[model samples]
Target chain A: MTTSTTPRVCRGIGEFRTALAERLAAVPGEASLGLVPTMGALHEGHAHLVRLAREENAVVAVSVFVNPLQFGPDEDLERYPRTLEADLELLARCGADLVFAPAVEQMYPDGEPLVRVTAGPLGAVLDGASRPGHFDGALTVVNKLLNITAPPGPVPFRAYFGEKDAQQLLLVRRMVADFDLPVTVRPVPIVRDADGLALSSRNRYLDAGQRHAALVLPATLRALAAGELDLDAARARIDAEDQVRLDYLVVVDPRTLAPVAPAPGTLALVAAHVGSTRLIDNLAL
Target chain B: MTTSTTPRVCRGIGEFRTALAERLAAVPGEASLGLVPTMGALHEGHAHLVRLAREENAVVAVSVFVNPLQFGPDEDLERYPRTLEADLELLARCGADLVFAPAVEQMYPDGEPLVRVTAGPLGAVLDGASRPGHFDGALTVVNKLLNITAPPGPVPFRAYFGEKDAQQLLLVRRMVADFDLPVTVRPVPIVRDADGLALSSRNRYLDAGQRHAALVLPATLRALAAGELDLDAARARIDAEDQVRLDYLVVVDPRTLAPVAPAPGTLALVAAHVGSTRLIDNLAL
Candidate 1:
């Protein structure tokens, strides 16, 4: 059966839940629900995720919530990209059945969450180190999205997240295991431009000159993956590049995110400010 | 249809999930599942919770885990009650459909949870102030239990907690609201003995003299609730009792748990050390 090109847009939590439930119940047997959660910049990466979900599940629900809880006081919450109309068009082409675009009030009717899912020691490193509470906010919203999309009875419920946010993907997997949440996590690889810059909504902030400087992020990861430079050499290479200010570059165990000797399955992660916009990228060594 | 008198005892997480799912699937229509979370050492109070679950839900699950995370280093982790056999017996009598009694390792296979549900400022007051991270641990385990027992599709799922642990009940309600968990929280009233002493598993630690002295806790609440004494007088009354050490006595708004003048619906909470055992009780003023 062909899914309708025009996916239903739900702005309220109760409406979305009820709509999804009705759709799932109408499935011939037990239905598998797939969720692609995004902040709604609707890039090629998001399209790839939605297409993958459409191919795998009986139904796909995409949540386009730029969660306020996940943003620091000084962060780009206001400046964060929100292109809902364009997002809906892309989701339609990608075969999404529903779009859950809740306003901040609908998602958090009770103001700030008193209880939140906290990422322990691991959350204090990398992006978390530079932007405190970033992972906590990301993980908390992801947790909420996962619960929101969960089916009433157990069939197959899976959520698709990009591997570009490697730390987030790892922490989300950890949370699912920790909470014993009944959804499976499917990781989609990092989608990059032809020039090899990893796709990010924040990439929109880059100027023509800053965009060229940001290539250092992917170049640093490629060099580390190719064994052309060691950890210190990688850091120095990014530091030497004009307009690219290195935040951190380290090779660590993918599972533990702890500094380790570069080896297969270890991940090389780098963050840099290309102009005023910060960008992060990772590569498996 | 009669539920089996001998509730299936599941020792593994996977086993319990599978067993519960299969039972739920067997229900003629959509099934409502009820959960009563406890730390074993079954008392009449637990039976009351289970019976309420029995009355309300198509299937009932009781989790008997004395979560180590909720206990502090200086507190009674080693000495906490464990009466699983008796607990199972009471559950069976109370018409519990299933008993999930996982080993610490089974519930937390990867040691302590790296990601936990934290009760914010509310967690740092009353019981939280006395025992740091206590509510955080309680909330984490409770979050896990709700997720574990959650059905695949949207069916009615509720978890029961006694009002005896007023702070815990309030925090659990908050966590459920914050997480937007699929489970409903069912609050059962505090079950007291004929003499008016609140039932507690830790009451097992009390000697005859301590047990007699523990009466001061409920008496203080009674006096405060009945307007026989104000907050200051209630503290003094509990302090004057022989062998009773006052911990804290305050009248607070039930919703916010903030200090409020004595009024109907405000909760009067009392905690004290009767000999070596610490006890807490609350009454609605």
Candidate 2:
């Protein structure tokens, strides 16, 4: 019924929505609602977002659902971890006031949504290219979440997204703008572990040797973005590593995600398979 | 200032949104807001929908913008009528509380929206097949309109749509259901003329002779639906007419728009070019 830190835990949309409605009703038209959406393998990165929301808002809600729409048939949809019990405990410590942990049937009651919101050219490259039709699915759930949590009147609804998934963040920001959605997306800084590798749920898949190999990704991105190492050098360094198989290491325009001509204001993003664990990380140039 | 009907007229989104916000605030937590979207060529059919909205809700907002998204590139975007003064007067008589008559630039400030709501297989047949990418545009604007008029929380937002544009009505309904949008789509019965022809803005393009030829369309649809005439006989009768070239005449599943095998529960729709003007009409089987 409750998390350790006074957070109301709601299993159904109706339950959470009513809880949200009562919270919004207390402060009519005041934009104090903040939403942080996640696929529940909550780590320090998700905690950081929730903490930011707690500081910025009176009522903060965290949604935990592993969106099945965003995964390709061959991808790790089934393999994706479900750690709600742990996620709730983490969210409580991070100060999330409420959690919407709906069943898959609740989020998608009528099966696959026929009407879908698509990210155009921006979604077609980088992350979107390898996983075909991924952003469209991600966006469908994101749109629904935004709508589901959207305030009744002109009440401010601030949504927090992690820049760790850089392309996903960009697409979400654009979706909010294009659709004139009521919520403003606030990008939280990407949280990193002490060793400099970006913390990710997929990192759980890496063995001891693979974990050591995964450090090369952020290191390569950092060197490339800092102008200390050229892309060729970065690629060569990543290739020399034993376990990691390089997927793509490209410098792109931060907003468009198009491969740029190595300018100062670019983002160096890398994705690779560190012994069967596919991981992505980006660094601002 | 005011239309003949004394409704507040808002020319820009900024103005309309603020006005709408204030209007919705005065009656907080009550689902009294109703929206009827149109392209500003207000005929009796549009007025009928607006009248229904006025009767159903405490506050009714009618939007009159000729959406460029729904118009095909080579289609009659330029030739579309702009009768704001006349439209306002009609809205006033229909008991609309306010009108959002935004300019094209206001509606699409960023030019073409990169993010769009797409209608899938349901949008691919009948009128959709004839005008590729048409319903997507329709759904996008409809989605925008719904969001703009969406109540901050869940106080009830009902959208009125005419059944005359049968495919459009179905697609909007599906889009609402598919996205789990909060608004309810209330379809009004088709408003017809004395001689059984569907009321349309493009009907003005019909000359005396074209008007007479246009009667054959509705007549054919009616006879086919009544089972008094078979598809072949209806096509022959329509083809035997003057100055009218039938584009398509098919009986389809009303929900999916897939072509049906002359079943009872179907929709018989017809499109024809009477002179330089294109027109469409449908009847329930």
Candidate 3:
């Protein structure tokens, strides 16, 4: 019943990999394991996901890799945050059993991977349509992580996701079902700030004025969810913001993420450039 | 090094899997393992592949599973040969270390699988075009086999195939490269009969007249290899025999299996029905 203060932290992919293998081997049997994959600039949102994983499974493996494949040539991979030491401290405090922080090269040694778990019909719409090859990268990395962490026996592994990335969660669920991978995918509720802005690592890039302007995206989405504004009107409200360069504000089916005419259960997805950083957030309506 | 008189024969997928695990565990850290996937009615062609695998790798594992996915709904699945005893004898003689004979239900308990590996450009033409979803089935089953038989550590598992199944071999090689699976694919030279007929399991279904008629397929292909035969002439030559119901006589690029202008390095493939049984053969020019 005693809590340990000192936390175990692994720096590089090789070191973490060796530790992970030993840890998995130590827990012989009857260990219910869960994985939370993330690009670790740990926030309250990530902690919420970790807490959920801890509550549901006996072991929690959180991977911190800013996957390069998911980033386009113009995207923010180089500038992506790498607070590994802080991330591990947070994970340990949040009751994570292992922190898998693999290097970019370790995850993809042969340059960019070609094995893409493409979303057949769902791919050419919403986030997929906007960011070409984004979901493919997400699914590929998830696939590798799932394979690597999957127990040697027939026991299935459980995975957790935050609802902020709703499209990613749905796509991953679809990929798992399609591939028949015996893994459980659970989605935790989105964590937001007092000002109604969804928590994101890119928030670090926003200056005072740009941060205030970024609030308009979540504000518009909240308005749509509360039925105060129509879809087009809400989109216009966000577009009116001066510092925010709107990429897309779409309403789509929650399952398929395909653009849908206003339905009862739909998702409002927002992507915009506040300053130079491109930030994305979504909410279920 | 004394050879045992009686070689072990695995009856089902579970037994074969258990046996394989035990065998692999016994030989720790030994490299150069090879796999040869086959359906159980072993012929000289299959034995040749096994022998090739034996010569190349320190350990050779052969799987005998008549994958139902590869066969069309109307094609032979039930009627296909299942000579487990004879097949094991052949494997033993060929010096295979382990023989994996899995049942249909063991392989696909949930019925038909959804994860299909398509040949993309190569898959949509020739054999792929003729037999829809055939390569998908072939690739899927091969992927499963490779995953199961892959080395426990960092070393890769090598697989052997016959050039007789030119399209299958090419598609499998494509799958290996595409997935970045830690496996080497080795294609053995095509083994032929004394009369130049490519050996196949379906040859057993041919009656005396039909068997004699089946020879025309290889003969016409050989003739086409020697000289420039127009598509129409090649078709006519393959269809010349009365007993042979010509299925398709396609000259295609060996790599992509797409139809090409009659040229050197192209593959001329023929499939015909001799009586109620269908037979296929291909020759690279």
Candidate 4:
């Protein structure tokens, strides 16, 4: 099959909906749609998700919007990388059929939405505890994206997310189930660089020294996952790294995201600051 | 075109979804779906919504779940009317194709949902202030019902709501826009009894004298709507009723739900207690 060189870009919600409906209608019989939602600073991680979506469905649509609501007042909303040109190139190569890159105003025509999806108790702990209103904002935007991409017919619709954002993945999964959204969540494994640092849009902010120092996050997780370090040992290991300031390194039940005794299926989560950049990573133990 | 009587009833979420999808698939070329969400006392008001849905769409679905989330701690959750046998008879006569009547446990298998849709400031005034977290609960369940009834493919999904619950209808409209839900909200005019009292499931609780007293709500709204009484005058009219106790009588901007001076498009809302049952009514000025 010949692949298209460029994806049809949609800058507005109505345009995106119409484009998807027409595309779905053109298919001869049954058609499946796969969605890869991202705040586009396309790296191997996002491309990996798109590749999976392309392989699994008749049409692949990717959304690239740097959601402002997810970031705190003091957080890096302005400086977050937005490599749209490069993102389209990567998506085209990965066989994406469409890309919805809505502006903030287009997505939220009435400013911040008064009606929103709130992550209840789960949002109160872990990343939520550190970044107040972060998960709520994330869930709200994700909910919108899911509805925005929902198929016009009963055709299969699945959304792809990288397991790198474990808390986000869980909340989104719960949101779909809680709301009965007609979309499937297909989680892609975290993609790491050859140096073991998980790819993040903020990684662009890291200089050489901070980049090297950021490896402490994954390194500690590796030790914990390999049974070479307990929670205390992992905390001590990250603390010894002079350039990396340890935030929280705790073992949590993967299902509930609550701190739990380290067990086989529990997840080890770590967050820290390499220079001024905040980074997080996790591993299934 | 022939219509089926005795609408099919679905008691589980999965069952309702599949039933709707298959029904849509059977339609010749294009199909349309309309949903009427109610708490099942099958009053004339609900019948009005279902009749509108039947007239407008190829398939009409009515949800009859008595949502527990929408009721407050001291509210009439336990005593709220549940007349499924009669509800089905009314829906069949109204040409509804399906009825989703899931039990509380069927709807909330995981107990209380941690994540939910919240109506911010719009939910805080009028009825929301009197029943704290009421709109939040209402929006949460309504959001779920919208998702549950969302067409598999975009085949013109519309939800019918009675304007009797003015706050709720407005919030649902906002939620659809905020979440970019795939459904359109169609508001049917308030369905009042011959005596002018708005039909509500809770109306079943009012005894003979109390039912007559409840007419004060509609009387005040009618006066305000007809320009015979201003906000203060309407409040006084209800306040002077010996059997009716006034809760709040005010004029609010239709768009923002915030208090505003009476204008051409302003809405006058009244909430009062006749005996132990509370009733609310609204009229556009």
Candidate 5:
């Protein structure tokens, strides 16, 4: 059967897993596969990731699951974007072979419970330090997805991830290694606009002026990267800005996300309020 | 392949899982299946559980894995007995369809540093209360085994467990529910000898007199079940006995494994050292 633009969709993890297995089986010898697990509201960033997977693998499975586990009780789980039909069309146009759009019930049938993947020493610092249990959710869901899509034999599978969520990517890599899952995790570069705005589905919540003000994040990160500003000074400069409400601005080691002495390979992550929308962006130094 | 008496042994979880899948596929349509996951050194207790699975399901998969995750840092991991050849022979005689003997590397290839299925309230109480990380190990390995052996499609699968370790059984059941795994957990009666000694692989460590003294566990449990003693008094009585070091004795609810106020459906469990070997036994009150 020829691939369809509006790809075949499965609603639950069980059904999706079964369907994926069956579909993958039809493809001849050792399918070179890549998975782009995401919460679907396909922006330019998501498109870049899908493109990367499409170019790299014989088959690309893009999972659009708005996992509730990762979100805190008071967070934006309820308000998170849900554009499935549009997302599928976009995925198909971007050359994704399969678009798995599972519901909240499908991803988490067991309800709101904790499945933690300990971050060791690094977990207690950086983003993990600020948001408790956040890395746990990311690791748990990623582990489930990896298990579900694991090849039947020793054949290796690669997972495509965006570097925008740097900490999440690191933790996922850790989980794959720690669990010995036969899958390689490849982190794709962050896709940004000409104005340096990192595209996010949550970006939709920004109003016209708020969207303009959001540019300060990319600007601050760029300033830090250019050696024009120190870490604390850059953070203070961003904080002193009137329009953007700074949530967190810190520099740390890119891999461990631990606070370092401003050495090379440091990641400067920033989260702030640009109007009602919370915008998060990071730059590697 | 007509069930081999010369056990078809595998060295890893992946290999074992692949072999099991192929074996299950050979079976004719929609057969009921049961799993009896175990650490090797198969005794009457494990054999009886396998026998029950054979009677219950059209296919029975008996997993023999001495899961290292369940062992604590200072625990007897190295000294734990491994008789894979003998275990398979025993299973073959017991009418088991498949003997899934996976190697330590197979089950935990990348070193399973993280565990699964933690007891929320029931954990810090009974056996969990005493052993610390014991139930976490038991639950994690059991979860992995269940996922590995879960039946395809809507029908789900059933697993048979011995009630000799009442707390372990309760924790496993909770994990199954919490994860919404499509498997029914059935706890079978504790298999015993003519002398009323609960069968265990650990019994191999006991000398003749120590083996005889081990009978006090089941004997004491039987006495409690017959209304010959109260909970605390029974524990104190067991503690007072000679030639054995008492670990713990408590009457708890069978389902929760929580200390019950002397209710009927309660289970009285005893753990003690007979010589250098630790023995545990339980009886439904």
Candidate 6:
């Protein structure tokens, strides 16, 4: 997924550090630095985060790293998309001043880290139950990015994430508080296409029929949120949908991600397979 | 183990943050901030760290929290030692600028953190093996202290630690590097008494005879370093002592804390029981 586009790519840690330092220096006083972490293949969803950063920060750095730690051995570790060039173009349009796209070796010099940040019970449910060790990987790399991009002068360094990764956002919030990290984590609303399908890099994997079937994801979510579908009714919609296999569709406590009594203002989450690609979607009542 | 002495004690995270903010502001531009983390029961060894911090930084903060996370249920979590009054007097004599003494709840607002920083395989041997979850607890709270005390303006913050806890020091160093923290972790030389026994809070648990028996620790360290004692010979030295029980004495790779080929510039660690109290000591060969 390597693109031919460009936007000040920082291939190494030293370059990224230098670029970040120089950028912060150019801001003179009390600069608000914002970070948007992405795995390349940037779409409107990622741009939305960069745009919020651009609106709120004097300096914005978008990390286009395809973190290997977050990908499992059986998952799409190798084939996960990498559209650096196109991502750069999108970020530039969104006013991202710097792009940190380090090589795998640059981010992990000694290979797998000797120490790791683990997500306990909260991470073992929902999507975590489907993909074991996924949240651990996400937390480890996200923590690293938060640290590596930690502002030099404590002028308020914030990291922006999308609500599509609701669990990841919550975990990041917890990790920052638990570690007492000096960074603000902001979550952007989930972005979707005109077709109502939630935007995802994996959305590229869906065939025409699979793409149409994926629409049921948001449809079911909207129905559940609008009271048109109860827990059983949503499960029925997912089951009745063709060309897609439902993994799980249950409402959970947004804070701990635990299954609880369904009610308004709670979260309804779904995970399913459209052909060979897995998809997840969620909404708040 | 509650201490009766107080020196501007910060009871909660908000107070600690505000106190630290005020002290750091008092120093203004380019102020060097130093931190000394201790589990109370401070000795001259702890004072040595404060002295170095006092000399190196314009602002020095000492955290005195007896972290329950690092204490095993069966171990001395209940009686590790807390001499807050004496500890504060020592810090005052050392010219500490601020003392952050947070309660257990302050550090952990949500009970035990579900998200934990794990020490991986490095924490599985020696003291870690003897006391399961010890290193994990050490790493977790140490990381929290690091985050809680992170400089507001990056005026060159450095944390002072003693080398007496060689493994703890190494692990702290590892955690700092692993997390890319914004502060420098400074290691002070191991402070020892005239008798050569390393100073420790747990030394209070020793009786006169047990204290005398504890000298075998430093003696064997010196012997091993001088090439006068082999592994078996060192075991024999401890076996010959009375009122003291040898637990485990092995030379280890200072980097990984695993037993390795003994050599100079590497660590030789030992843990033994002086009466009912357990103690650990290490030295670089």
lDDT by residue (A1-285, candidate 2, tens digit) is 123575788888778889898876776546488999999999999989998988888789999999999999989999999998898789888878888988989987878877888888888887788889999999889998988888666567899999989999999988887787888899998899999989898889888899998899988887786788888999999999999899899988887787886777888888888887889999888
Q: Once superposed on the true structure, which residue ranges of model 1 sit more than 4 Å away at CA?
A: A1-4, B1-4
Ten-residue stretch with the least lDDT total in model 2 chain A:
A1-10
Model 4, B129: alpha-carbon shift in Å? 1.0
Could you tell which candidate, 1 or 4, scores higher by TM-score? 1
| Docking quality category of candidate 6 according to DockQ thresholds | medium
Each candidate's fnat = 0.88, 0.67, 0.07, 0.85, 0.02, 0.72
Chain B in candidate 6 has what TM-score? 0.94
Estimate TM-scores for all models. Answer: 0.98, 0.95, 0.66, 0.97, 0.77, 0.94
Best-to-worst order by DockQ is 1, 4, 2, 6, 5, 3
Q: Which TM-score value belongs to model 1?
A: 0.98
Pairs of residues clashing in candidate 4 = A152-B153, A152-B154, A153-B152, A153-B153, A153-B154, A154-B152, A154-B153
Q: Which regions in candidate 6 have their CA more than 4 angstroms from the true location?
A: A1-7, B1-8, B25-30, B152-154
Tens digit per residue, CA lDDT, model 6, A8-117: 77887667777887878887786889999888888899988988998889888899888888877788878888887678778777878778888878777777776778
Give each prediction's DockQ, rounded to 2 decimals: 0.81, 0.70, 0.15, 0.77, 0.18, 0.61
Consecutive 10-residue window with the lowest summed lDDT within model 5 chain B: B110-119
What does candidate 5's lDDT look like per residue over A1-285, in tens digits?
233566778766667667667766777575677889898988889988888887877778888888776777767889998998799878878888777776666666656543333455445555666667666666667766766665544344789889888878877776565555567898988888888899889988888788888888999999988988887888788777767888888887775566776556788888887766777899888
Leading candidate by TM-score? 1
Q: Per-residue lDDT for B161-259 in model 2, tens only?
A: 998888899889888877778888999998889998899999998888889889999888888977889998998888999898888888888877777
lDDT value, candidate 4, whole model? 0.89
Q: Score candidate 5 by TM-score against the native.
A: 0.77
RMSD values, in order shown: 1.4, 2.2, 7.0, 1.7, 4.8, 3.6
Model 2, stretches more than 4 Å misplaced? A1-3, A26-31, B1-4, B26-31, B262-264
Ranking by TM-score: 1, 4, 2, 6, 5, 3
On DockQ, the leading prediction is 1
| Of 2 and 5, the candidate ranking higher by DockQ | 2
How many residue pairs clash per model? 9, 7, 0, 7, 2, 2
Which lDDT value does model 5 have at A33? 74
